[model samples]
Target: MSDASFLSFLDDPGFLAAFVEVSRPRAHGAGLDPYDYDRVTAPLASAHDWPAACAAAGQRYAEAAGRAAAEGRGVTAGEAYRTAARWYHVAGWLPHPDREAAARTAADADEAMRRALAHLDPAAERVEGDGFAGWLRRPSGGPAASRPVVLVVPGMDSGKEEFHTVVEALLARGSAVLAIDGPGQGVLTAGSAPEPDYHRVVGRAIDALADRDGLDPDRIAVVGLSLGGYYAATAAAHEPRVRAAALVSGPYRLAWDELPPFVRATLVQRCGGSEAARAFAARLDMTALVPALTVPVLVVEGGEDVIPGVTNATPLAAEAPAAELLLVPHGNHLLGTALPDWLPTAADWLTGHLTAQR
Candidate 1:
């Protein structure tokens, strides 16, 4: 019965279509230069030949890297790095237990950061006086005291770059944003850092940001994506200074009790072999913790999100002291696709709450 339900959900045309549309762009964006989407989507695009397709993609990436390097000046080094990173992202998604694959993905992200640093002015300044990780993005064109500031926390398998798209949008709107690599995320993923202790880590991040110059520390808001949502809620609860919090395609609970069997099975298959994955899963259970959150929150869920159903939203709304839910029709787990349309709404919501408090 579970298998049948799983297969049925996977076969849903709407689900598959949304998944493909969101995933394809991510895959394409992962690489530096444009590649034929047809070739890239050939194998792993579907379950029938996912394994073989992933293997093929890995080979293509490796071969492409060599060719680009040989061509030298014709293909800039930046292109090479992008191509390699794209392959690494694909390699990370492949359903295989290869320690080397994860290591390579981490290494590629590190290299991309290096290249990015060389070209872009250092916009990030480290925050001292805290054990927790924190960084600030200065408001451009002199300090604007009236501008709102946002502190963003990423989900599992996420790093600072995940906010690249959103940060540009916020900055254009005259908002300063601070993004952090919290425990078990980003560079911490490759390090010996401890798994996230929700309230503690977030509290530290807030404490560090509170004293930064040009920031209306009291007007600060928090946006947590995916698993970061759980942490964000907890932080909002403990920190009375946070004016508002938003969760983009985020869930209330850590354990995916509402996930369809196939999705759960897929996760198990993906992480089953890794001790680290197993440990991560075992520690993530936020159901009991939701009731403790007292801040005003906006829960954004995809209408067709198969992993966390409508039921998840209900409990969150009920549990949160003050919360509202926004369902994006035809949206999926990846929030960026709908961000351009939804961010304005989110920004307005944050603006109302943050600015009014002042």
Candidate 2:
């Protein structure tokens, strides 16, 4: 017999597949370490209480963060809080309909992350728009306080919280960075369904950034990861204010019918339901859209990414007038395995292009 809790939902193959998809620390976000992943999922291996196990794992990390903070080890404390946030995010997921408990945990995770970010150099300043929120960071001791900015959008299941590493990477290269949660993403909606008109979402972000003090309004670059690639491309096509655009593992043409059930389910809630979701995804085709791209663009793909298919980069390169395509031979989705390769390349590309504009 099964209980009427979130654990019952974990038994579903789709849920398990979803969990396994992001189980890799290297290939996924920087929030969770390998040890945290194993610790959180270990209880699920048996028939024991899975949620409790997740809580225990999160608590362990929180305690570790406390200890690190007490010792004045800021970096250690930050990393520990990052892991705890991921655990709390997992703990918030449920098999049943009620999401209150999970949302509360996710809020806790966000606070932990904010605290962690405070201890790091090039510290993040929280920013908000009418419908979304984000964190802004700049390079430490850079030539000028005001610098070019890269606007980053996370994947379908992720939000600005998952952008910790990317923000640091951009700052290291002397570029200010802004990572945001669009209408249906993190902090904004408590994990609610997302809208399809991501261009509008991005436009609002740009508008907000335009008034911000320490960023060059005319030198803003946009980068999207995973499903966010689609959002970035669309935003660039319509938002003339964006100086350069980059799509990493984004789909030029969406195949809503072919998407896995887990992906569809996650999207449905964001889009309202299956009917509305399909209609929303169907509008995501960037085929004709890329041709309208008037600014420099970069499309990077992984040879091993079967989900969105690696070949999606081909048409994007051919259509966009100033597009450059980079295909990593053994890279996985998002080039997560090839971070050392792609992250620097993207940063260099943005830096080079934006510098030329200045």
Candidate 3:
């Protein structure tokens, strides 16, 4: 047998290259400062070392958060816990060979986020369902009984814990935010397969949040990034309860055969096999599906976010009759490089639509 045949996919040159390259922008976009990303990853030389290296950093911050909390330094504790959570969250992305251990690591990330929110926003609530989990929070000092709601959905290989900035942005604009991780995402990945009919997952989220006090059920909006963007668009088209949406770096279509091996492998891991991954990939295309969406939509595209085998959101924006497009030339897939230009604008767009006197 060839030595190559026995090697873990983590060691494959292409997998290593793509994981390392993609990790930075995704980390930064998710809340890690770029400088911290460099420093944390500098000593790492291989994908196999990635989880341990990141977890070590996460442990350090987690300890710091603990100490800060014990000292009654609430702000410091909050910041430390958030940083710790981000590290652990980053650590959980790889589809490791030790599936049980990988799942434990995911749980650690999930727990850290809960602690972070306890310190950061005491009002934050954890919401869960059959195939999803989320942190639901309202605007600071929001008015009683009808604050517009926004569902902040994360992408494939992303979780509810990562989009802190997006959640905060939406909260700042008077929207109650639910940052969610659905099937094949966040902590749920260990148990659930990816659902290409993501609208169902979202429908369940809406049902969970529907009767909550101080959140307007009829005024719900969605802001999703990457694969989550596709999910949000899917829900907007089919779930009539979704009043508005913002898509960030979502694919307009996906061709299974053309996808990068890392992406395909991730899907394979989540979808159960190569054939299932192929089937799910085919379901991701929105070339014809998005045109029927009637709610106000904002599609945010990173001009530089060219991924193999994926069609970007530009065409979705152009085709959806109610869509408005925001293109950022220097942004990476998640706009980690150009946040200021797109984040607020999109948040404003969503809140405006949700709060409009409709």
Candidate 4:
């Protein structure tokens, strides 16, 4: 990477360093051991070099996965495939000046995810509707007699491929997972765009899961990250069937002026344009909506988060009929660094709430 480019990577508006650091744990979640993450990233000479290096790292892992599959090491192969998917995803992030390259990397990441899911425990089933797509995974040992289902929603840039760890955690507690790509997210962005009333999408997802066998429709829950947090709460408030909701670093209202230009641009693109995005952001206020959340609600926030900040958790929990706020003193956005502290707890809370109603 050029010296100028390196400085750009360190620039505050971009928050590149923080993005890379936070993404590390996610790569680990994708099965790249810590040592591998360091080894692959240690050689990055500049900001521009990282993506190409990351793409190369993914290729190397993909080759390894192929070899393992040939040797009948299904579990090992699955791990490698997942790791490759993460690396490819990392490359796809902030791919500037080369939109075509970014698209290709993103497609490769999705393919790797599919390959990984094939070897995962209980396997994952690909599900689709008119304008949405997702992958569903049952509990490890297979569906329980009557365990609940949790719909996992991703934030602006995150996709279903990055949610394998969340799925595993929920499955361990006997809850099946449906990690979805809503309108304008992941592979579901062909003709649709992001909407303020995401409950419309959530309601449809619930409808699909309700008709499925082995899942308890009455115990369904929604768990979201960042912007997804907003979507989850809105869904629970508007959809009477959503028994519980969990929000991780979601904002009650969009800090439009506070958002960085690039982030704002992405929002506009996802929301169909500037006017629509602004309209959607304006409609995101949960002041009146949170009071209607009749079911259990879990709001997790990091004290150090700059995007949504710790304050966003207040009104959410205060208005909800049954709600709890977990504040991690040193956590960042999505509480990525605090996963060990929050993931299990969030999963347990979801299980407890769903089970209590039974």
| Leading candidate by TM-score | 3
Task: Put down candidate 4 lDDT per residue, 129-163, tens digits, no spaces.
Answer: 75567877787665358668899998776677676
Q: Which stretches of candidate 2 lie over 4 Å from their true place?
A: 1-22, 25-31, 46-56, 70-73, 89-97, 121-123, 308-313
Decreasing TM-score order of the candidates = 3, 4, 2, 1
Q: Could you give candidate 2's per-residue lDDT for residues 31-149 as a string of tens digits? A: 46666576557556532344456657777888999999999998999888877766665553332234455456656667777877777643578877766678788888846667898
Error of 1 at 256 (Å): 5.8
Per-residue CA lDDT of model 3 for 37-83, tens digit only, reads: 78877777787787888878888998999999999998898888888
How close is every model to the real structure, measured as TM-score? 0.69, 0.86, 0.94, 0.87
Clashing residue pairs, backbone N/CA/C < 3 A, model 2: 6-95, 193-269, 193-270, 194-270
Error (Å) of candidate 4 at residue 277 is 3.4
lDDT of 2: 0.71
- Sorted on lDDT, highest at the top, how do the candidates line up? 3, 4, 2, 1
Q: Lowest summed-lDDT stretch of 10 residues in model 4?
A: 1-10
Displacement of residue 337 (Cα, Å) in model 4 is 1.5
Candidate 3 lDDT (Cα, whole model)?
0.83
* Residue 213 accuracy (lDDT) in model 3: 84
Instruction: Enumerate clash totals for all models, in the order shown.
Output: 0, 4, 0, 0
Q: Tell me each candidate's RMSD, in Å, in order.
A: 6.4, 3.9, 2.3, 4.0
